[model samples]
Structures are given as C-alpha cells and as structure tokens.
Target: MQGIATQLKETPEGQISLTDPDARSMATYGKGTGLVGYNVQTAVDTVTHLIVAHDVTNIVHDRAQLAPMAKMAKAALQAESLNAIAD
Candidate 1:
C-alpha cells in the first residue's frame, strides 16, 4: 500500500480522507459518476462482538446492505446458517 500511496501522491489522482491512510479504497456502488469510496459492513457476536467476516463493498444505498450485513454476521457467529432482518 505504501507503493500505491506513493504513486497516487505522485500522480494527478484526487484524494479523499479515509479512516486510515493504509486502508484500501474502493469505488462504492451507486448511481454517482466518478470516483467514490465504498461502505464496508461487518457484523459480530452478541457476546463477544468480534468481527467474523467482512465485505469490501461500495454500496451507497443502505437498502442493499441488509443481506450482506447479515451474511457477515452469520460468518462471524459461525452458525450453520441464519436469517437477518434489517431496517
């Protein structure tokens, strides 16, 4: 990532403020045109709240985040399978 950051800094690419400079930035899913950041989702257990699996995505609409969020939650919980409901 250092190499990529150095290259981006040396080029004409625009920059956006990220939570971490070393974190990977991906184009988020939406109708917008041009460069955008992705909104990643993660889920954890009720007891431990430890992150299991995470999805790297650029979904701008909260509406579409449900299944992915639930899936991540299930993975974290290590359940054979589960159902998720989001509002």
Candidate 2:
C-alpha cells in the first residue's frame, strides 16, 4: 500500500479511491456531505420524457454539462440546432 500512498501523495488532488479507481469524491447539499461515484448526465425529450442522450463522467457537478449534453442530444437526434434547459 505504500506505493499507492506515494502515488496519491504526488497527485495534485490528493484523492485516492481503492474501491473504484474511476470514481471520485463529489460534494452534496449539506455541509461535509459527499459521495464517491461517477456523475451521470442525461438528456431527454420534454414531450415524450424519453432519454435522448447520456454520458457518464467523474465531474463533481452539473454546471459544465449542459452544452455538451445538448450537443450530444442534437447529434443523436440529427437536429440542425438545439435548445437546452437546465436547473
């Protein structure tokens, strides 16, 4: 375990997850509340409420996912343009 510890020490984030290498620590609503997992992003049609596109990433939040997901959904549907909405 010393080698793993040493590698983690050298990393800029200083985070190491043994259970799942691809997962990361993510923040939640309450103070000191967090979870370790991948973030799942999905785009759906409002009328049909059917999933159009999806992506799994290790990013901690959804702030940066809107445009990329919209583009993906657009490509999936072969649309000329897309109007995306997020909360």
Candidate 3:
C-alpha cells in the first residue's frame, strides 16, 4: 500500500491523491478529484457482453497504460493483435 501511495504521489500527471486511497469516480457518473486508488481497464465484446480483457494499475495517468494494457489484454485473450480503446 505504501508503495502504491508513493507511486501515486510521484506520478507527474493526473496524480491521484492518497487521502482516501480506496475511492474513485465512475467513468460517467459523479465528480472525482482525479484522485484515488487504482486505474482499472476492461475490454468487453459488444456482442457477447463478455470481458475479453482487463487490467488494474497503480499508476495514475491513462497515457502510459495504453500500450501495456493492450499487450496484456492481447496476451490474456490469446489474440495476435488487438484494437484497444480506453477512456
């Protein structure tokens, strides 16, 4: 937990405050301080409503997560390549 707190504190952009380390804003609901615990990503099939991929990260910024998460998701789904998206 302390390591995560340190990471959040040192992150340069969209640094999530650690005052309350277990809270976060919904993607389309409520107001958030751009602070909180984890960054989670999920990729679901529109047709089947099944989660094809997902990841939970301690880093705050979304910018750096794209490539890593995409790679992880591809590996998890056993896909050669993927068209990844995030918000």
Backbone clash count for every predicted candidate, in the order shown:
2, 0, 0
Best by lDDT: 2
Candidate 2 lDDT score relative to the true structure? 0.89
Cα lDDT tens digits, model 1, 15-63, are: 5345554343454466544444666666655566676666765444567
Task: Tell me the TM-score of each prediction against the true structure.
Answer: 0.44, 0.87, 0.50
Tell me which residue pairs clash in candidate 3.
Answer: none
Ranking by lDDT: 2, 3, 1
Q: What are the lDDT figures for the candidates, one per model? A: 0.61, 0.89, 0.66
Residue 35 miss distance in model 1 (angstroms):
9.0
Which model is ahead, 1 or 3, in terms of TM-score? Answer: 3
Clashing pairs in 1: 28-58, 29-58
RMSD of each: 7.9, 1.5, 6.3
